[model samples]
Target chain A: MMKVLTANRLTDGIAVWLGANGRWLERIDHALIARHREAVDALEQAGQSAFHDNLIVDVAVIDVDEVDGEIYPIRLRERIRAKGPTFRTDLGKQAEFQQASAA
Target chain B: MYRYDEFDHDFVGQRVAQYRDQVERRLSGEITEDAFKPLRLMNGVYLQLHAYMLRVAIPYGTLNSTQMRRLARIARDYDKGYGHFTTRQNIQFNWPKLSDTPAILEELAEVEMHAIQTSGNCIRNVSADHFSGAAADEVADPRPYAEILRQWSSNHPEYSFLPRKFKIAVTGAERDRAAIQVHDIGLHLKRNEAGELGFAVYVGGGQGRTPMIARKIRDFLPEADLLSYTTAIMRVYNLNGRRDNKYKARIKILVHETGEAEFARQVEAEWDKLKASELKLPDADLRAIAAYFAPPELQDRAEGWAGLAARKKDDEGFASWVRQNVTPHKHPDYGVVTISLKPIGGVPGDATDVQMEAIADLAERYSHDEIRVSHEQNLVLPHVALADLEKVYHALLEQDLATANAGLITDIIACPGLDYCALANARSIPVAQEISNRFASAQRQQEIGALKIKISGCINACGHHHVGHIGLLGVEKKGAELYQITLGGSGDENTSIGQIVGRGFEPEKVTDAVETIVDTYLGLRESAEETFIDAYRRVGPEPFKEALYGKTSRAA
Candidate 1:
């Protein structure tokens, strides 16, 4: 299973959820809601909602799950997204495994 | 001390402009790494493992106080706070960014220095004896001719993209301080029967995996045809040298395959066509270059041994420094002092920013504002008065540059090995440090006498291990660092290729092996005057082999 979390930009913060076997499946949304201007004004006049103005320009979604934490590929991707790629750590285990299989 | 002429200055300026454009293109994403690789390399910018490295040529190891100060400024501003002087008489900045290289080159051009031909398959920086003009045993100074070659080869349109990088060295001295025999073309200056200066030229000498002594191509090449003849030889190699295998691309392989006589004949045939052409150097051009290297004015001073003895008696440290660092000069009242870069456990050839400034200051104060970087990875004050030796020694000591181990055992030549170099197989400095620590005692080193131990991390032989009296080659064996030892090599007048004694030794066993070889020499030597090379030549490697492997013979 795999899931994606979105933020403002690539350099902005990111969070992901992983399922068992070190994978993600469920997506969670935490975004601003947009409403018609008249409806918002009416709500403000009637005092039905606390929000009176402002329309949503952006939204973000996150995925969360438990993971087995043993699969290297899933762990590596999570690690890279969390931090950054290792500059001098040679190649990943997946590449080494592929090479071994090819050999 | 060859200053740039109008033509040289213009050529360097054009090169700097070209490099600036290339750097701009690289930064603007117009050129990819693959496309810009050769372009940047042509300008002596290398994308090394961690960062970009720029190799600046110090032609024939000669520099004035102004140039030294400029190098110090470059180190302080552009690079990391230090510069590593390489074994090829070049200085490498290990931490220069890609974008700052052009500005660095522009600054270098201000001081009449550039990094052209320091890399790539062009004629690299021409090297010569460090004590070129001042040595008493010299036939003539080789720098003027070196300068002539430098002019002829700098970005020569036809031969720029040769089979591989080419190197040339010239020496006029009796002792081969320039390691001429290991260069692509080694020119030994000699005078003919008519007292005309000429060159005894050797071709195809190099020190990689297939280490070979250069063979004599011409006994006496007249000074007039120097450039034209050199061009002919290079052209012949450019056309005939190997291109298929990078390992076999050097002219040494070409000489090996074609036979020396045939190669010499081919060069002669090529020269016959081009000898009287525009490529030949004019006498006026030669004289112009020679004028720049004219000796500085000397003052007649007391020549007696009084000054030296007085210094020796007054300061023991100064006495030790003089005993090791001071070398006889052509002038009676002066001497050459080698500031050893190989201080006990320090990185060889590394001078910190402060150290560079201090050396520059010392040169200006005491050395007639002249300094030289020897190919052996040490700084030289070419003209130090005998009376001021103590003063200079104390000043050097303040900077931790005063190590009295000029030609001693601990004064080892080591490349920036695995710690820094991307090409290295194993670390060279630790091994060198181990050796230094094992033989740190001054008394022991003095007893050992003049011994040169050169170590190279890989087969490229940048550290010139093949020419050392004791050569150590670092190799990786089963994921462990191993060292191979060779005995009996000499880079001097009677050049000889060292012979490998036996199989490789583990790192832990190498120091003991070296000690055993030294002990074997001490036991077999005829007298204390017989150096390590002489003893090795006299007795051969059998005794040393016996001492190391202990009667167990390994199949070759």
Candidate 2:
């Protein structure tokens, strides 16, 4: 299993995942992946460091799987966090880019 | 309806200013999340799954037109154009920014509302009967006492950091509309043999991972002793409540461990010391507070009796709505109207800003300027003349707020589970939507009659599943959503924790399981008048279990 570091940004509490570019991204597809044990440890350390830096809150290292070069969180909770609330798809990060930005 | 005095205004303003400063510091990285979490929580700000959620308290579930309008404006401006009405009768904005919360609090304070003490290990909002002054079954209005408790408990230094959060609910009717039996402290206002008003006090009832009914500690506590007795219970619990593990911290756990009778004795011994102190309320003060809740002078709209019947005959929709969503008022010409937020295949308690503004307008014009948020996740016009109901129904239909199921099967109570909540193991809103859609037919629902299906994403039971007639508790089993069903629970006067029936059902199969339970209940029922609860109570869970699972339904 692979892992990815995730947290909600401190200002607006929007869910974000640590990306390979060393910046938090809203879409989980671009998140930094850790396929080995040592890489997973590095991701956990990065989550703690980001949390301590006050850039994010509720930091976690969640399990993920890559299929056909697409990343998907193993748990439904994380999946919802990555996309949007299953009940109101029109309101969360999964909404249209312009509409979500407007919100 | 209580106006903010100079002191109230000043207190709320200062708190808002304090929160503004705290938010600024956190944004600038001068304060850490660990240090700033409790401060924000005290102001009702929470960091949820996708965004920061702001829970605004509606004291005793009462709000005037102006205050409600302000909430609508807040929903439009700060949130994503909608808000969730919680089972505790509070409204939550699911997408508030941490930085904008101070301004939201400022707007709320301008209307004599605030998010103060909505969270934290303190006395949360004091809830009262939604039909306190209007219900036909009358004893006395309970909101004044609830207001008094609100005043006494706000920012109290001694009780601010209790072992766990505390809740107090007050209801005046003997029918128990407030679900007082399921609160940390349940106060039932009643009349003694001499016709003097007092309360029947029940303590330690709560629902969570552990569900327990409160014990009747005192049958009739005099009206003036409200503060004294409450303080005594608080002091006893504060001193002895378990601080070892957070899960076992509620006073219900204490009452269970030390027998309910002994817990009452401890509270009594503590009360003996504080009964004569300043805690004893004065008659003048009580009267002064009660004056604020004086009912509006209702005019004689007696012609509504004939006009309403004719109107109902003209429109079957209005007649069915009248049968389900209207409750008789104390005044013969008036009726309490429930503006159902449960539109078929729609979210349970999420009202759009436009809908909220429309309700505010309706309350201002026709409902004595009063609005109530019920624990069942519906907006209520506490007093509407029967003659105006036809007009009100038409207006509600425009806003998609005219669902005729108030207590029926489609009228489900659901929490913001994994959808927005951080603690939920499964999704509650979708489950509620599925179940509601399955039972969407109004005719079928009316036939089922007064069935409460409460859903919770986790064992915390914020959705009050432990007390629902048909309770569904969602858990994560092997990383998938599983719902366990419970039978025969209720939150009314004779409150009982529902007993868990057979094994769990997967998400795809949960709705079918619920339909099976409802079908089983309908078959065993003696008559149409026998409610699902009555039929279940008459013949225990064996029949329901056998229907759910053949012979293998021994126990979970």
Candidate 3:
């Protein structure tokens, strides 16, 4: 299973996925996929360092599965967090993601 | 409405200044999240799934037009143009930023409102019967007593940090509209044989992972001893409540561990000492506070009866709204108008800023400037004159607020579950919306009269699912949403924790299951008057189980 490190930004508290470029990206699709032990460990380290630096809070490495070239969270909670509420399509990061795709 | 005095103004101003400094420090990286979390929580700032959610105290569900307008302003200016009213009669902005919270608090304070003691492990905002002063059946207005509790509990040095968060509710009516039995301390204000006001105090009742009905500790405590008696109960709970397990930390567990009888004894022993002390409320002060809640002088608007009759005879929509939303008031000329936030398939308890502003205008025009937030997630204009109800209904219609569903199947009480809450296991709003949409027909809803379908995403029971006529608790099973249905739960004078029907249903099947339950009730009910709760009580869960799961199946 691939893992992605995620946390909410300190100032705005928006959920962000740790991107491959070592930047916290708001879009989960741009998240860094750590499939190996060393990469997962590095992701954890980045999360820990980010926490101490007060860049993010509630850091977690959640399990994800890629199918048909699409990444999706294993847990419903993290999925909701990554996207937005299942009911309200126009409100979360998903909305922005949709907007970016449409554009 | 009780106006904030100078002391209140200074107190709120100082707290805002203090919180502003704390927010600044945290923003500056001087304060860490670990240390700042508690401080932020004390001001009702919660970090939810999407963003920081702020729960502002409504102070016993009572609000004047100015306050309501101010809340609308916050909704428009700070939040996402909407606010969700919770079961505690508090309004929660689902999309508040951490940095904006201080300013929000400042704005709230401008209207004599604050988020203090709203979230911490302290006495939370004291809620009262939404229809307290206007209800025809009420013994007296309960907001005064609730305000007294609010004053006593807010930032009390001794009880600030307890084993867990404590909730207290007051109901002046015998009907138990405040859900007092499900609170940490439930005070039922009543009159004794001598016609003197007092309270029937129930201690250690709460709903969460472990739902328990409160036990009556004192049959009658004099109104004067409200503070003294409550102080003693707090003292006992503070000393004895379990702090070892976060799950078992509520005073309900303490009252359960120490037998209710023994708990009563300890509280009585503690009260004996504080009864004659300075905690005893003076008559003059009590009267003074009560005077602030004095009912507006209403001359006999006897012409309203005929006017309302003619209007109702003409307009079917107006008649249905008045029949469903408006309840009898203390005065014959007026009625308590409940504005159903639950529109068909709409989110329960949510009002957009525009809708809120419109409601405020209606309150200012018709309800003597008073509005109320009901724990059942509806807004109430408690003093709407009968003559002006047509106007109120017409105005509410303009804002999509005139839903003629009060105590009906569509009037659901749902918490912000996985949709927004960080602690939720599944989404509650969609489920509520689905169930509401399924039972959306006004005729069908009236047929299934007085049915409350309360939904919570998790076992935290923020939606009061444990007390619903048909309760749906959403749980995550194998990474999917599974909703368990509970039967026969009620939060009225005769409160009962609902019984789980059987194995849970999937998200798609949950509404069908509710329909099955409602159908079963309709099939077996003796008469239309026998409510869903009453029918479920009489029939037991056997038939409903047979209907939901096959008769061959067993309970989960």
Candidate 4:
């Protein structure tokens, strides 16, 4: 079981996940997977520190699964946040990611 | 259509700057999210499931072509190339950056639009009938009073922090197209026995966890006492409305608990104290506000009706669109054309930037450069000439907006639901989409005849599911999503809360169940003239319940 720290960027209200490099990344694919209690605590502390620096808001631990070496949020809400509005696939950040990946 | 005066401009400008600074402080860690939440909400910025959603008030649902175009431009530049017109007759941008909100507000201000009082516990946007000025049956244009209320309620010092949000609606016509009966304060313009213009006031009506129809408090309130009476009502609610439990905080609960008589007494006492105050609009000021909403000078273009009839005969789609979407205007030559935002399988109320621009262009060219956002999640070109119906229909068809299902079955009113809203338990748009697709045929929809299917993702009732002819309320039972069906509810002059029928159905089975109910109604109807609502009222919900759940299932 893997968990990752996720929050909205305070400046832009964009969903960002805590990366393996300890920086907030917009794409969840780069999220740091916390497998141990110590790792989770460290990620939580890092998220708190980011809050103090006003880097992110509404930080929470989100469940994720690494399938075929690609990280995906397990919960529906987190997945929606990672992508965009579910109703319109062509409009949200998910669409931008798709466009970028295609490019 | 009301232009912002110097004072109005300065007020909005100052608020934008103040919000900009607040955002700055929040970003710089000077303010915590807990502390900044209310402040951001006060400025109509909400952190939804994904991003910050900005709801800009379309005061009384009126907009000019320039303002409409600017909204499209903002949608293209700042948002996701589209916007959702909310049920409160306001527009919501689902994806607005918190850092960019100040700039968005600044841009909105340029168009004399703002997100002030759009959210928060304060008095939200004052909405009126979309066909306010042009409605043939209207006693007076309600937008003037709605505008006056907007000016009075915007950033009011006293009602800033209420127990819960308050919604006010005004309707000038007897038809009650504004759904005034379900608002916190529903004002219906009326003429007294002496033939003097006044208002019949209804208080405490709201649709949420507990849907309650407003009780008529005043038979005829003098036009001069409009603001003073409103101020009194708000003051009474502000003081007496529950603050302990958020669910019971709405004025409807206050009116329910205290009883209508006691509430009316308290309001009257408050009115007695405040009726002669500075809140009372003078004759001169009233005239000034009313002037902005005077009907447009319509030309005598009734002569071209023969041509329009010929075109309608040639095109079956156009004829159907004309029959369903076109509304009779106050002027004989003019018609109110409703552009359905609910295209087949499309998200309700979602309009793209290009579609918006095209709509604006059509408004400018055909409908006196004015547009209206109906509370039913549709746009109205309120003054299109009857002769121009063919051209407008073709133009709308090109944009894939000519759904021709205005008040028919497919024009659904749905909240952002779980997909976009943080508070939703189940997704509403998908369900709406599924149902819309189920009833995709124009011929079938026409046969079904005027069925409103309102879907809400939660008990908040933002989708107005409480008052739909066939209301679908989504609830989370254990882990699975279940939809509760309510039958025969209406949000009209004869407003009634729909009764729940039998048990909740699984999400996949909900649309099929709705189809079953519609089929039952069709079978039981007296004639083709007997609409869904009328038939439902005449025969009650027994047969429908039997069709939904088995014959053994007891109706609630």
Candidate 5:
């Protein structure tokens, strides 16, 4: 199963994915996927350091799959977070990402 | 529309400044999350699932046009262009950042608003009847007394760190609109035989994991002794209330364990000692507070407006809306208009930035520059001229807020649930949306008159599910989300806790189960005039139970 590290950015409380070289990406698709045990260990270590550095809060690992070259969360909670509120399709990062993708 | 004094202003300013420094310390890692959690919660900040949610108090659910506009500005600037009004009559912005919270609090203070005592173990916002002064049935306005309570409890040193959070609700009318019976301390303003205004105090009422209707501890308490008596109760609870168990620390638990008689005796003994102290509310202060709550002068016309009746005759949509959404005012020419926040298939109690701005505009123009947030999760234009109803209706329609389902089934009350709240076991808004979609027809909703469907994401009962005529509580079973159904609950003059029916249903089957319950009520009702609660009261829950879980389910 595919996995990625996620946390809320400390400054803005927005969901961010762990990206290459200790960077946090707003878009989950840009996340640096961690598949092997060694990679997962490295990701966890980086997450702890980020927390200690006061860059993010409540870091966790989330399961995802690359379907049609698009990353999607496995759980309903994560999926809803990724897509903004289920009641609102016009708000949140998902809407912004979709607009940018279409453009 | 009570203006804040210099003392109140300075106090809020100091609080905001102090919180800013605390936030700075937390950000710099001088304090851990555990150490900073309570401090953040004291300022009404919560770490929700998606972000940091900020709940700002609209004290007693009353605010003016300027405050409402400021709220709109905050929604546009700080949050995701929207805010959710809660059942406690407060508003929550779901996407605030820790760094921007100080700025937000500073902005809120400019309009005489703050998040003080909105959360944590303190006296939360003192809620009052939404139509306190406007309603014809009211004996006196409750907002003045509520404001007095707010001033008393804002940041009292002794009661700041109670065993658990305390909630108080006040209602002045014979018709209980504030759901006072389910609060920690419920006060009903009434006049005694000698024509002296006093309060009938109810204590130990709450609806979380343990739902209990408040008991009337005092048949009549003198108006002058309000503060002393309240302090007495608080003192008793603070000293004797349980602290070993968090869930058992609420005053309701103390009252339950001690028995109502013993609790009343203890409170009375404490009150006797404190009554002679400076806590006794002075008549001059009461008069001053009451002056601010005097009813707005309304123009006298006939019993009903001719223009509105004509418009109702001409347009079906306007007619339906007027029938459902327009409530009677104390003045003959005016009406209390409730702008429905529960639009069909939309999230309950959510208003976008534009919608908030439009509502503020409406309040400024149609009403007396005053707006009210109902505990039922709707906004009210407390005093609109009946002649101007059509114009106001059109304005609301333009903003997509003119949904004509005030007390109907579609006007469902739901918490943020798992989608946003960290404490929720399952999602509630989706279930509400599904039910709203299933019963989309306005005519069908009208046929099922005054059926309240309240959904709670968890046992905390933030959605007031325990008091709903038809309640749905979301619970997690194994890995799947399940909903438990309860029937015949009400939050009125005669408040009763709903009895849970047997067997929980999967998310896919929850709406079907709700429909089955409603259908059973529809079939078994004696007349169209008989409400769901009335019908359920007449014939017990057995028929509905059999319909949901087959005839041999043994729900009886």
Candidate 6:
């Protein structure tokens, strides 16, 4: 229900699914996306490319809805994305996991 | 005069380094514009409409000859051979490049200065009475306490990330030269019944869109608890202050919403936890800070009244300058000289390189190498000997810095409105110029008597228009510039927000409106002693309203 789509002509582009009813919003070169290399890369891989001397990015996404045009799974996914990951995912946590694996 | 200790030095060095890293990252494409926005803002670098502006703090409006010289150097090397001294006792380099800020910070740090906490949502460079040490009416020097607050709030982890930018002002004198009531936190230094130092703390005063005079939170807070108590207030504001709307994010709004009594109770609860902390400043530390600001050695000399009288009798120009620019100093043989940056029709606060050097020379030679940037956007030599007044006045006249309109109607405070500010809705400088030209007569100004006319291009109130006796606010209506007039605002000990007189006026009609208001005041005034504000208060705005709108109009 939730789709992360990237534009072919933009870099650091993100297409967020807002609600159902095929309402897809794209934010390009946003501060948060610009800060996260992985997020930017994911968008780039999904077809977003550098534009306007690499300063701007263009991206798009698609969303399907139920009979009433109400977004359900897409809404949930967008909410999750907006809030970010709940658990710790930094290098310190990774190192702890690595130590446990070695033990 | 608070010298940067090892800790202070290290912190500034680290701050510069951190900002350098952020700059490097932004330049190298490691971080995008979005990520670097906050980072740049935190370093006092703003991408203004035309160019990047670097606001360097002049803490408590106090500066030594060396610091001022360094500022001159910065103006010469980095910026266009001039700088704009702001209402907040800070200087802004109007044309700094984004890439050159780190080097600028490095240079500033060399002079025991940094742009830290200047632009960020933090305890900004705490402003104080310009005549802190030299004012005739001052009970005690306020700079020592200001310096203490500066240190306490510098990189103070918890309060640094508040909902909005915060400003604090201190004054030891009875006359509120610092405009304390319009600041986020206003500290009035007072001696208690037991002869111990204490603060009459006021909270939630600010001047942006909603200009409110700070309400007194604590009638008497012990001097030792200044830091801990302030920390508690800031913590409470940071936690409970609204972040949803940027306009309502100021502590004033929070205080308004929660009610002062409840807010004070909450602050008290927070202070209970912080009272037992290491934030309580030691007597030795206070003494050490106070030692740096100890009064300069005074020479026993005659009051030079005869020399001043002789000059006044001989030269009309010298007499005019003395009448307007000279203020009473605490020392019998000394007087405070305000070297006007507002030269006739020039920008209100802009000083060229030559002017800066000239003032610096005057400060070192005549005054005691102490220069103060007043909240009214003028420079002051706090301790000019009475004998040297004529010489200093002549020198100032030569440099075109001597306007001799310190508190007159010509001494207008206007923000860099639509011309430079990206947020301005209308032009402030031109309107200020129009008003200044209208009141160009010395006789009329003397009659007006110490009136403040502040103008802001927008509701942001960067010009402190809310506290002006005549407040001009520029608003956009139907895509045209319209000016609103407010009367009877006072920024002194008895602070009050000005009330809007009537409907907005066209840009061209604003001067006429101001004249009408002044005319009304003059006609209604009981005597020469009763100022525009006094007459307005006594007679009410009805006369002024009648003068502006006429009797036939029914619209209030």
Give one digit per residue, the lDDT tens place, for model 5 in B1-556. 6898899999999999999999999888898777887898999998776688999999999999889899989999988889999999999999999999999999999999999898999999999999888987889998898999999998999889999999999999988999989998999999999999999999989999999999999989989989999999999999999989999998899999999999999999999999989998899999999988888888775645777778899999999999999988888789899999999998999999889999999999999999999998999999998988999999999988999999999999999997788788888999999999999999899998889999999999998899999999999887468999999889999899999988889999999999998899999989899999999999988999889888878834
Best by lDDT: 2
True contacts kept of each: 0.00, 0.94, 0.83, 0.63, 0.58, 0.00
Residue by residue across B404-485, what tens digits does model 3's lDDT show?
9999999999999998999999899999999889988889999989999999999999999999999999999988999999
- Tell me the lDDT of candidate 5: 0.90
Ranking by DockQ: 2, 3, 4, 5, 1, 6
**Over 4 Å off in model 6, which ranges?**
A1-103
For model 1, residues B221-287, the per-residue Cα lDDT tens digits are 9888998899899989999999999999999999999999999999999999999899787899888
TM-score of each: 0.84, 0.98, 0.98, 0.96, 0.95, 0.84
True contacts kept of 5: 0.58
Question: What is candidate 2's lDDT per residue for B1-556, written digit by digit as tens?
Answer: 6888999999999999999999999999898888999999999999999999999999999998898899999999998999999999999999999989999999999999999999989999999889889999978899999999999999999999899999999999989988888899999999999998899999989999989999989999999999999999999999999999999999999999999889999999999999999999999999999999999999999988999999999999999999899999999999999989899988889999999999999999999999999999899998899989999999999999988999999999999999989999998999999999999998999889999999999999998999999999999999999999998899999899999987899999999999999999989999999999999899999988888898675744
- Highest DockQ: give the candidate number: 2
lDDT of 3: 0.91
- Candidate 6 lDDT, tens digit per residue, A1-103? 2234423211112223222222333321111221245644554443333322333332344332332432222332222222221121221112223321100
Question: What TM-score does the predicted chain A of each candidate obtain versus native chain A?
Answer: 0.20, 0.89, 0.92, 0.89, 0.88, 0.21
Question: DockQ for each of the predicted structures, in order?
Answer: 0.03, 0.83, 0.82, 0.57, 0.52, 0.02
Report lDDT (Cα) of residue B89, candidate 3: 95
TM-score of 4: 0.96
True contacts kept of 4: 0.63
Model 4 residue B161 CA deviation (Å) reads: 1.5
| DockQ, Cα level, model 2 | 0.83
Model 3 residue A68 CA deviation in Å: 2.6
Superposed Cα deviation of residue B552, candidate 6 (Å): 2.8
Chain B TM-scores per candidate, in order, are: 0.97, 0.99, 0.99, 0.99, 0.99, 0.97
The true-structure Cα RMSD of candidate 1 reads 12.0
What digit string (tens of lDDT, one per residue) describes model 2 on residues A42-65? 999988898889999999999988
Tens digits of per-residue lDDT for model 4 on B1-556? 6999999999999999999999899887789888898889888898887788999999999999999999999999998789999999999998888989999999999989999998889989998999989988988898899989988888888889988999999998899999999999999998988998899999989999999999999989988899999999999889988999999999999999999999999999999999888988899999999998778888999765898889989999999999999988888888899999999999999999999999999999999999999999999999999888888999999999999999989999999997898888888999999999999999999999988999999999999999999999999887457899999999999999999987899988998999999899889899988999999999997898788777777723
